[model samples]
Target chain A: MDALIEKLKGQIIEQLNLAEVKPEEINPDSPLFGEGLGLDSIDALELIVLLEKHYGIKIQDPKDGKTIFQSLRTMAEYIKSQGKS
Target chain B: MDTITSYAHIKHNQVSVNGEIIFQSYPSLSLPEFLSEAYKALGVSYPKFHKMDAQCKLGFLCTEFTLNGTSFLTENDITKTAIVLSNAASSLETDRVHQHSIDDKSNYFPSPAVFVYTLPNITIGELAIKHKITGENAFFVSEQFDAGLLVNYTETLIQSGTEASVMGWVEVDGTNFEAFIFLAEKQKYTNKNAIFKPLNKTSVITIYNQTIWTH
Candidate 1:
């Protein structure tokens, strides 16, 4: 789980072109949107692409994105549940 | 015809406002690196600028400099300001970056942020959003700088309804880039004492050529 969370952090940084941010600074338990990473809608689309390209994960429902992408930990757990972690 | 009220020319390492050099780029820095440094030097803190493609960034910076000392006009009547920019590349720089994103079938990851900038006119949108400008806007693609086209279009917009126009030739491909933006206003509001050239094809072409060639 720790390794998965760490990997997701790197992926998010690179995929979003968050050049000023370091992986260590991204707290796994913190929110990925709003108060945490402060990413916008466009970044959400980039994250969706990241999931599809890296883990072969296709989120069927848009509503599920809120829970699945709440944080790095949540995303990792969701991937694990899908058996693709 | 409208007369030029303000202008800025930006190259890789230097930025000239009204034909006067104001900012110099570090020769050692790469294009991306120089842009980052230039943004810092300009004391602008817009985070979205970091996400923009090279063409948009160049246009944004050029406009910022063009309107630098004209804060009174920009702050008072932003809605009256229009933008008409022409370029040779027409977002080809961002297209290349976007193409690379989806080209690798094994590692395909098309970024939405990058994809949004695939259109050249996106720079006009960016400028409008930044300045709250709701006036006329247009983007043209030509083989080279078309002084006649820019002059005609800008003059028509000014004559029709718009009070002023920010005309530019913003072209970018990788590290090689050039941007020259001029703010043209009707003769009624122009100051006689101000050292501004009239908005005509010959003068515009001369300034444009001088900006690129002198560098």
Candidate 2:
């Protein structure tokens, strides 16, 4: 789980173009949206693409995005539960 | 006769305002480097400037310089200003960059950030959003600079009730790029002693042609 969260940080930084952000700066348990990463709706769409391209995890329901994308930890847990991580 | 009150022209590594050269750099600098240097020289911080495509960056920088000296107009009046710009490439260079991201499904990592700027008029949209302009806007793709078309269209808009217009040519393709933006308004002052040039096709052509650096 720790390894997965660390990988997710790098991927998120690269995918969302947080150019000045470093992997160590993102807290695994903190929120991914709003005040945390300050990501907007467009970044959310990119995150969905990131999930499909990396983990092959197709989000079945749009509502699931709210919980699954809550944090780097939650995203890693969701991917592991799907056995795709 | 409407008059062109202010203008900015940027070609090669040089930046000019109202036909006078203001900034120039070494010939070896790349487009991105030169634009960054220009942004720093402008001494304003708009973080979104760093994320823009080359076309938007060029248009943004030129608009900033052209309007920088125009403090006579209030923000409310400025918001009513219209923009009409022309370019040959029409975002083709940014299109190529975006295309490379989705060329192969195997290596594809399509980016929304890149995909958003694929349209040429998006440069105008960026300007509108940045400057809070809500007036009408148009972007033209042509084989070359059409001063007559620009002057005619801008005059029609101003005559139809647009307060003023910022019209120019901004072309960016690969390493070749140039921008010429000017402010146009109906002749409000008819004093025979006034020296400002009228915004006719010939004057527009001269302003654009003045930036041509002979190799």
Instruction: Give interface RMSD, every candidate, in order.
Output: 1.5, 2.3
- Model 1 per-residue lDDT at A38: 88
Model 1, position B97: C-alpha lDDT score: 88
Q: What share of the true interface contacts does each candidate keep?
A: 0.58, 0.37
Tens digit per residue, CA lDDT, model 1, B1-215: 56777788888578888777788866667777777777877887776787788888888888988887675364435677788999998999899988998898987778899999999999999988887888889999999889899999988877778877888899998778889888887665345645477888987876775554233
lDDT of 2 by residue, A20-66 (tens): 57899899888998978777787888889899999998898989999
Q: Can you write out model 2's per-residue Cα lDDT over B96-144, one digit (the tens) per residue? A: 9999989998888778888898999988988888877777799999999
What residue pairs are clashing in model 2? none
Q: Which ten residues in a row have the lowest lDDT in candidate 2 chain B?
A: B187-196
TM-score of each: 0.87, 0.83
Question: How high is the lDDT of residue B71 in model 2?
Answer: 54
Displacement of residue A55 (Cα, Å) in model 2 is: 4.5
> What lDDT does each candidate get?
0.83, 0.84
